[model samples]
Target: MTAALAVRNLGRDHGGGQAPALDGLNLDVPAGSCLALVGPSGSGKTTALRLVAGLEVPDRGDVLLDGRSVVALPPERRGVSMVFQRPLLFPHLDVLDNVAFSARVAGASRRAARAAAAPFLDLVQMGGYTTRRPGQLSGGQEQRVALARALAARPRVLLLDEAFTGLDVALREDMHELLHQLRAVLEPTVVLVTHDHAEAAALADSVAVLSGGRLLQHGDAGRIYTRPASVTVSRLLGGRNEVPGVVVGGEHRSALGRLRLPTDVAVPDGPAVLLVRQEAVVVTGPDAPGADAAGTVLAVRAAGARRALTVEVVSPGGAAVQVHAETSPGQVFTRGERVGLRLPSSAVSAVPPEDAGTEEPEIADRRTADAGRMPRTHRVASPAVPDAGVRPDAPGAPRRRNHHGDHGT
Candidate 1:
C-alpha cells in the first residue's frame, strides 16, 4: 500500500567543507503523491534521495514512513526502491530475470518470480522484450525495463534520481507519460530529484526547491513559481526580470517604478525585489499605451511560437537594466526599437533580495548573450529563509500562462 513519507531535520556532511550535502531538510510526501526536489549541481538533491533510500546515512534527523522510523533498516528491508540516472540493469541477465531479481531474492521459485514480473513489464510496455538483455535495448527501452524492475519489487516509496535526463525530449515526454501510467496503477509514493524546474512542475504534485543544500521554498508548482521566497528561489525558477527596489508605504518603488503590493504579499519596509515573468511583462510600442517602465529593445531572438527580447531601460534611482520579455513570434521587434513594458500588478511578485550587504545576489541569467548558465555555487549551504519574508500562499497574483512549454516551470 502507498504510505506517507516524512523527512524530518535530515542532515548530511561528506567532510572536507562546512557545506553539508544536505542540511536540515524537512519534507513530506503524501500517500500516492510526488514531490520533486529540484536544485542545481551540488545542491543536495541526489544526496537527499540517497539518504531516503538507505543508500547513504544521514548525520542527523530521522526518516519516517507511515509514522514509523526506519533508520536501522537495510535498503532491502526499508520497502523502498530507487531508479538512478542509469538503468543499472544486470548485463548478463535477460529482461525477465532482471525484473524478477527482487522476487528471486525473496526465495520465490523462478516461475513464480517471472509470473510476478510479467505484469510490471507489461505496465512499462517492456513485456514483449522479456528475453532481450540490457545491451540489446535502446536508452529509453532500458529505462522502461529498469522502471518495470523497480515496480516488480512492489515498494511503498519510489525514488527517481534524474532517471529521464539522458533521453531526448520526445523520449522524455514518453517516459513522463509512462510514469503517470505507473503511478495511477501502482499508487506508490514518489520522490523525484531533478535540476529542471519544468520537469518538477510537470511531474510532481508539489515542489521543494533547494539551493546551497538548503530548502528555499516548497509548495505547488504555480505557487512556487509565482511566489518564490527569496531572490535565490526566483533565480532557480528562471525569474530573469529582477528589479532592485524598496517597499515603503505598501508599495514597491524600484527602477521599474512604483507598484502597489498584492494583498497576499506582506513585507515590512525594506529592500525587496520585483519579479515579473517574461510572459507577464507586456511589451508595446513606445508611444502606444504608455506603461510604468519604458525601455528600448536591445536584442530579440525568435523561438518558434514566442520571441525572447531583451529591453534596456533606465530610471533615476537605478542604472540601465535589461528586462526580458516574451512576445509572439509573428511580431517584428528589432534592436534599438523603442518599447513600453507593462508589469501588471496582479502578475508580479514582491520578494526580499536577502542581500543585506552591497553585493547583489547572483541572479540566474536566462536571457541575452550570456544566458542559460547556472549561478555560482556557494561554499556552504545558504541559511534558511526567514518566515517573515516568505509569502508562499499568494492567491492574489493570478498564475501567468507559460508559453515556453517544457522550457519553463
Candidate 2:
C-alpha cells in the first residue's frame, strides 16, 4: 500500500541548552493506517506531527504525501487536518456550525458546509447535538465536534496531538473506537501523539517510540511492547521488574539466577541489566521448582486490577525490585518475608547496563551520539525501582530505582 505520509531524514533543531527536538527521524504512515507516536514529554513526538501538519518546518529533510513531496506546501495547501489537545471551538457556534467551520473556511457556502458536516456528526454519534452551542456540550461532545470538523475538510491526513487528554476512561475508549471506525470508512491516514499506552494499544496499527528527540523503535504494537529494541523502550512501554545482573556463559545472570538468552545482541559479559515485563515475571511459591529466590517482602499494594508487591532483594547486594502479578492485596504478607523471585530467560531482555538509568525520575535518551564509549557493569541495586520514585506531582513520568538490592513501592 502506498504510504499516506512519508518523512525522511527529518531533523528540526531549536537551539538551546537542550538538543534538537527531533534528530534525523524517519517514519512512514501507510494509507488508511493509524500510527501512534509515544514517548516522554520532551521526546519531540509532537514536533514531528506539527512538521507534518505544516505548523512547523524541518531544518533538514522532507515530508511527503502519497509518494510526492509536500514539504513546501502551506498548512491549508497540504490537505492535512489537525486536532489540538484542547477542543478550540467557537463558543457561540452551534455543534453543526462548529464542525462545519473548516469547510466554510475553505469557501463552502453555509448550507453546503452544514450539509457536508451532517453525515460526519452522525458518524461520531453526535447527530442530534447539532443545535447545541459549544458551551452546552460536554468535553467529550466538544471533542467529537472537533473531530467532525477535521474530517469535514476531507483532508488526506489527520493529526491528533494528545486529543483525548481530559476525558475519562470510558469517553476515551469511545473516542478511540470512533477513530478506528472512521479510519476504515474515511480511509484518511492517522497519526496520534499520546503518552497513554492503552490508547496506543487500542488505536494504533504501529507504534513509534521516541526518547530524547530520537526514535528508539517502531513496529507493530505487540512486537514493540513485547520485545523492545532497547531497555529504554521497554521501560517507556510499561515494562517493569528490571533486574541488574551480569552476562556469563551465554546467558543473563540476575540476582534471581542465570537464564539462557536467545540472542547474544553483542552485550559483553560482566555487569548488565535485564528488563522484564511485570506480566512476564510470575510469582511462584518459595519452594517451587525452578524458583531462583532472592528477595523478602517490603510492601504490597492494590494495583488497580492486580496487586503490586514490593520486595527487597537480599542477594546481589540489596536493591529493590517491584513485581506486579495476579495476586490479591488481601493476600499481602508483612515486610521481611522470604520470597522466591524467578525471571524466566524468555521473559527478560538482556540489555547493556549503560541503557539503564543511574537514578529515578530521569528521562532516558535514545540518541546513540554522545553515549559513553565504555559500558560499565556496576554491582548496584535500586533502593526503590526507578518508576516507583516518580513524584506524585509528575503523573505518567518515569521514576528512579537503585540497582543494588532496594526494590520500590
Candidate maximizing TM-score: 1
Per-residue lDDT of candidate 1, residues 150-266 (tens digit):
778788899887788878889999999999988888889999877666788889999998877788889987677777777677777777778888999789987677788888887
Q: How many collisions between residues are there in candidate 1?
A: 0
Of the candidates shown, which would achieve the greatest lDDT relative to the real structure? Answer: 1
Q: Could you give candidate 2's per-residue lDDT for residues 1-409 as a string of tens digits?
A: 2248999999889777668989989998888888999876667787888788776789999999988998887676677877765666666678897777666666778899899989999999999999998788899998898788788767788888778876888899889888878877888888988877878988899999987778889999766776677667776786655678788966876555567765724567887777766665656566778765656676665556666666655546554545544354345555567666676555657677653344223333322211232212112111211111111123322222222432110
Tell me the whole-model lDDT of each prediction, alpha carbons only: 0.76, 0.70
Clash count list over all predictions: 0, 26
lDDT of 2 at 42: 63
